[model samples]
Target: MGIEREIKLALPPEQADAADRFFSGIAGTPGRDVPLVNIYFDTPALALAGQKVALRLRKTPDGWLQTLKAAGSVQGGLHSRHEWETSVPGEALDFVALEHACDDAAALAALRAAASELGERFRTAFVRRLWQFEFDGARIEAAIDRGEVTAQVSGQTRREAISEIELELLRGEEPALHALTVRLSAAVAGLTPEDINKAQRGYRLCAQ
Candidate 1:
């Protein structure tokens, strides 16, 4: 398991191009656009949600990956969470592999309890423009995600747009995330800190 430290910021859809230009100018190259399809799963009773745990299978250019994220705190858009991720052969989730990858006892127990009853609850499809660079002695990954979250409940479909910037500390002090966020916020107006993650949004959609 690894501690995923990142700062999430909400960006206005209209300002996406400007943000892209800003990152390109600073990084000295254009960002790479990666199309991603993410499906979130939970028990029908939402036991995982109640425990504040999130599980998802993501389809990337490289291959499929399953991730388990445990309950964590989000303060001022800075999210600190325990994450266990591993590559899978297909869209299906591998609970055995996930259990082995997970180091947190609570998270492991939660996965075991929910594994049998788990099913797809919602999905997020987005194109992530990624940029990696060294800033202030820190290796940071900046991503601009543009897409929407969708869920089907009671024979109806619900949707929400996802336009945000994520500044993650790949290897460095946490302060670097804030510094990069500050620079991006200043460069792109209307960028505000977002405390809610995509999983939370998916759960809320299911509730509605």
Candidate 2:
């Protein structure tokens, strides 16, 4: 288990090109675009969500990974959460591995109880443009994600656009994360701090 700290920002659709250019200029190279497909799971009653836990299987260029994120806190667009992630053999979820990785007793029990009933709730598909750099004695990964969140409910489909910047602290003082956001915010217009995460967005789509 690890504490995931990051700041999320909502980017207007129109500013995507400008954001790309800004990052490219700083990195001295174009950001790498990675297409990612993530399928979130939960029980019929959304028990996990009620517990503020989120589970998902993500397909990345490297391979499939299963992640379980427990509720943390979001303050001023900065999110701090407990995350457990592990690579799986294939598309299916490996609950055993997840249980082994989990250190929190309550979260582990919840995972065990929900394993049998878990099913796909919603999905997010997007291309993430990634850049890694150093700032103020800190290492950070900046991702510009563009795509949509989709869900099927009552024979109807719900969709929402995904255009956001995620600044994840790889290593360094937490304050540096905020400093970088301030720098980016000034250069990029229409950048608003976002407190809602993709999983939350997925759950909301399911409700509509």
Q: Which stretches of candidate 2 lie over 4 Å from their true place?
A: none
- Badly placed stretches (over 4 Å) of model 1 are none
RMSD of 1: 0.7
Kindly list the per-residue Cα lDDT of model 1 for residues 114-157, writing each as its tens digit: 88999999999999999998998899888999999999999999
Worst 10 residues of 1 by lDDT: 175-184
**Pairs of residues at least 3 apart in sequence or in different chains that clash in candidate 1:** none
Whole-model alpha-carbon lDDT for candidate 1? 0.94
Model 2 scores a C-alpha lDDT of 0.93
Superposed on all Cα atoms, model 2 deviates from the true structure by an RMSD in Å of 0.8
Clash totals in order: 0, 0
